[model samples]
Target: MMKRAEQKGVVENEAPQTSQKSKKQKTCSYGSVFGECDLHSSVDWGNLPHHVILRVFQFLPLVDRARASSVCRKWNEVFHIPDLWRRFEFELSQPATSYLKSTHPDLIQQIIKRHADHLQYVSFKVDSSTESAEAACNILSQLVNCSIKTLGLISTAKPSFMNVSKAHFASALTVVFVNSKSLSSIKIDDTPLDDPSLKVLVANNSDTLKLLKMSSCPHVSPAGILCVADQCHGLKELALNYYILSDELLLALSSEKHVDLEHLRIDVVSENPGQVEFHTIKKQSWDALVKHSPKVNIVMYFFLYEEEFDAFFREETPVTHLYFGRTVSKAMLGRIGMNCPRLIELVVCANGLQPLDDELIRIAERCKNLTAMGLGECEVTCRGFIEFVKMCGGRLTQLSIMEEVLIPDNDYSLDRLHLEVSKHLGRLWFPDMMPTW
Candidate 1:
């Protein structure tokens, strides 16, 4: 009788345990069916290591990361970790806008107050309004403990950075230059940035600076840029205007103390398109740069009026990527053959009703490394076009000719031309295609 009583007690204990287990399984299933639990909350995700979870979360956007934090308490902690905030881009749009959703004002304040120190790579892209620039400056001045490694100040509008007063932009930027002593990259284009602030930056972070891009800065003179090149021995990539590109600057960059430069970009922007006097850079200066850094890529972007293009492409240049914004003439295209022998990409925006047969043949014969060609509002004969394609052959990766560029003939009709070109390019060809914007 005592043995029977003991067996009954054991059965009673096992019964309740199994019942509880069943109840828990039912609850999990119900929740899964009702969408109350996501994949991350499921049993499979719970088994993942914490490091893997953190790595997955790191790749998510900031807004998506915020949503992910709600999955669990552990994820919430990982979302707020300082390491996750190292690389960040703050899209500071106004409260209500058409293009992009505005970042909340309260969240911006919170990030500045609590997480400013965690930002290592940060970029502030502002809208057209001056208010956004002011807000950026205000936050910049307040980052007393920031140790930013890379920082970019970008303006969506062309003239918006100038809308901010020079003094204000300079003073606020000085704070960041003074604090972030280990900055490696800085891109501040279109700002009314002057020399004194540059001096402050070079004095503090010149040793660590590597890549600097200020393509459209009008306030900085050649002397200011020279100072940067002299001090920043580790600079690898630089972009500037034709005005600052002098023999002395190239020599400064060629110093034995400096590392081998990798890329140099020149923005040929015109302030007044109607001006008669066109600025030019000597070929000898470019030759010296080539001697020092043979493998370096030289890229040039032109934003000129039709009148301003007369002085360009006078002699041999090391332009790998060339853009012509204005309507180009046959003479200019002809000179391009002689000057840009090492050309890789050519984009001509507009060309008059003249046939570009000779120019096209000249480019194909001379520019052996040319891989892409684009023509807009230009003319090319059918036979000339076939020979040009045969010359470019399989090497031409991109041949964007507007439908109007090819003058159809009985021998080389549009359909026949496309069929022949497609056989060469290994892709569907259409001469009527528009130039990629």
Candidate 2:
């Protein structure tokens, strides 16, 4: 019995030893396999050509490029390049508001510090929430100290905290004007600017400002606009909305020497000229403005209570682009084609079409440079479209017809129209069903 027990213990000990040896062999094989896989799978960061990597980064959006830099140690080193930062700034400003909102404040400051010397354009919005007025002022101060040329300020949000007297909002504005020596264009939205405020802005930076947009500013009056026209010698583009625009202001702007006005946009509610009674003085003012400023391109959005289309269409101003909305008659279209020979683009939105087919054809024939035409929510048939295309097939590159198709019978006409358009058209945009052809 003792001999049998000793033999069993010895067998048990030998079995454990054999199992341990097998387990060690398996682990070694797995380690070898894993090592080989890692060596083959690893990206050769050093072997990647510099220009190829830079081109890849250039294709990425600004935010994605920043993210790519964080992928690894080698990638993180690429962020130090100055040209990369400049390209990022350019792409970042394309979607200004969203980019500003997504980027961290600290990261923005870091970017400003690193690439401030190369900064050319900066657009930022400040609301009472998200950031304090003081913080906004600080950021603007940094940018002004930089070489930024274009500045856009949009105050979309109202004051968050009730401490209006203690707020640094005014100081922020002061900092903007004081440091913005290189600013050429300025766009301010949703802010009321009194005459005094306008004077301060113009007095400080009028000489350098080339374009100014003060849309949705309730406190801006005709006086303030005239003040800008008089003072800002280099002003080229002016956009005014919600503010009162008068004939006197237009007259003053017209008489200025070498006005250099390239673009003008005005939204006004006027009850004058050819509606009920012709305001000769206002008409003369507009005529003189257009005639005197040979280079100026005018865009007016006026709301008249009881004015005929003839009142607005009488001015034979040379416009590169024309857009008309509200209750416009088909007869007026013919008048416009006869008057504005230099018109290149026409965008019309009306309720019904009385007899504008001949007028449209005339426009296509006359305006050889006519590249785009937008007929929005108008009563237009596919047959009329086919006729227009046949006349201006070579010049018309873009035609947008929205909400015009009424009947199932028109589908066949639409199909034919699409086939004709597909031949000469390089780009086609439709709001409804996609074109079959």
Candidate 3:
């Protein structure tokens, strides 16, 4: 009996040992599977050496390119490549603190150092009103030596900054035009700039300046613009909004030296319209201006009264591009169509008019090369759009039906519209209404 009990004990011990071995084998198998899986899935993508990655980064916008560089250490080095930020300026989301923390100041310094020689465009805005002008000037000073082709400045009003007599104001202007040898385009808004200062800047760089835009610059007068027209013979495009524009200035623009001006925009200041009264100009003046400057291609007259438009159209002149905002009627459009047979672009924003689609269609039919058309805020239906497109055939390249027509929900109408326009249309814009691409 004792021998049998001892044998039983030994058997039980062996069974437990076998069970332990099985558990150990299962654990090992799991570990091996996991190890192999990780080895296969884990990859060092950043370590891959290829110029394609840098090229891809170049294709991305400035902000995205910067983010991509922040992914890893090697990428950060790649972001510092001088050529990446040469053509564009980058602004970080955070204020100066975060920018200093994350990015190397040397990179920014290098950008500023090589400004005019390498940079093409710049967009800058300041967060604090009190600090805006000074901060903006500081940034501009850094690019003084840059051959910047385009500069856009946007700012807000603080009583402190509103006083233009401050030293910061002159400093900003000086820095902007200091060494802009190759500068061609400049746009400024809501800042204090006087006529004399503007003349000085234009006279300094008059040879290279091609396009100039000044908006809400209360101090700019017709005389200042004439200074530009007289000095900058190479000027091709000009947009002035909420400034003083007079018939005398228009007459100056018609001079032989400034006749090369192809695109012109003049927005009258409602409060100061008395300074440049549209109704006061004689019909003969308009005719003389057109006769003197036959090369003017695009003309925009904003906030003009109906009588002023009548005077303008009474003159027999050829207009290739015309935009009449708030003062055009169906009868006026028809008169314009009869006068300008070579009209290639027309923008009409006449509101509260009965459907003038019939007149528009007639104008489209007459203007054979009508490539772009903008019917702003006028009441028109999809049927009018269809007929207009049909009338233009393949000549219409850009069509903007803003604030009026409703695109159908189904694909049939959209498809038909697309089919009609696909042959010649390069861009079709409809506000708040998405038609199938």
Candidate 4:
């Protein structure tokens, strides 16, 4: 009986070993060079429709896009497709010593050589370093057959970008401007673009140009901007500094040849340190602009010294979106309410000890289309805030007032405020609470 039981146990162990050996044989049938692989059984994402796959790839960042190209043989072919390479952005990092991943010049050259002809939209955004800017312009100069539709140059580092020479930047950019036949929109902030480059840009793409945003471009004079305004009749959007804006430029934009302009953005930055001086665009000019393009949105952004506010709202200004970078006074808020009748959005950084009771009420009364607002380190009574919300109604889509913005008055009540505001806002609303940090 013992011998018979031992024979049965041996049979059971042998059966399990045979099954394990067969599993290994099945896995090894794939014929991997080093080891077995399940290549035949894996999902084949490459079989997705070509257009659908390209659309999916469009949402990936440049780094991820490059990584995905190495996934498979079919994917490698799809990665080099011209359509997929049309719109590209170079997020060039700082130098290697600074511990940032800088773009390689050889990679830029390879792209220019291989895919320049297929390029339609391109932007060069560099960190605070001269080498990256050099690489950007170098890449630009080598775009031999490129016919990009939209070109944008941006600098993440504030002061270092100013270091690149205007001549070198312009020379390389002119190569692109002159080459492309159907350039439409451009954004070249903090670059040293001059009048000659403007002339070249307008000469080549006057008819096709629609949007131009060149803020902080000190080298380009009012005439340079005016030239663009006069020539580019199809231009719908423009952004420039205060110094570049003038009566002539406004009229040029509002001319009969030009279509009803859509948006005009002005950066009201103080040119000098501790300097309160500012150049004003007369109310008459603004009126003429409104007359020509009745629905034009005049957006003004103020980054100024406290004293510079005087020159801003002397008379009624047609400002739609207003932002005050410095501490704004109740006086300025009062002027904003009276003068900025067309204000659609207002962000006040600060108002002194006295509550902005009348100012807030007056703003709510005047600016009917006030959709979004933000208050930081400001003083306002709870009653005034409630009234403003009620008047503005649900149209106040994005009301971002900070916690300390509400001054403790007799009417201050967090629960009551929340209840009243939520009823009008169409959602639960409360003042932005102070951060623990």
**Winner of 1 and 4 under TM-score:** 4
lDDT of each: 0.77, 0.57, 0.58, 0.77
Which stretches of candidate 2 lie above 4 Å from their native place? 1-101, 109-119, 125-138, 141-144, 154-170, 242-259, 268-295, 300-311, 324-335, 353-355, 358-369, 381-393, 402-437
RMSD of each: 10.6, 14.7, 16.3, 11.7
Specify the poorest-scoring 10-residue window by lDDT in model 1: 8-17
Over the stretch 95-207, how does candidate 3's per-residue lDDT look in tens digits? 55232112223345545654345666776544434454455566666665666678776543333235445456756777667666566888776667778677667857888
Which whole-number lDDT from 0 to 100 does residue 357 have in model 1? Answer: 88
Whose TM-score is greatest here?
4
Pairs of residues at least 3 apart in sequence or in different chains that clash in candidate 2: 275-307
Could you give candidate 2's per-residue lDDT for residues 80-125 as a string of tens digits? 4555654222111113333334344445666667666566566555
User: Candidate 3 vs candidate 4: which has greater lDDT?
Assistant: 4
Per-residue lDDT for 116 in model 2?
Answer: 68
Q: Please provide the root mean square deviation of candidate 4 (C-alpha atoms, Å).
A: 11.7
Error of 3 at 32 (Å): 29
Query: By TM-score, how accurate is candidate 2?
Result: 0.62
- C-alpha lDDT (0 to 100) for residue 368 of candidate 1: 92
Report model 4's TM-score to 2 decimal places.
0.85
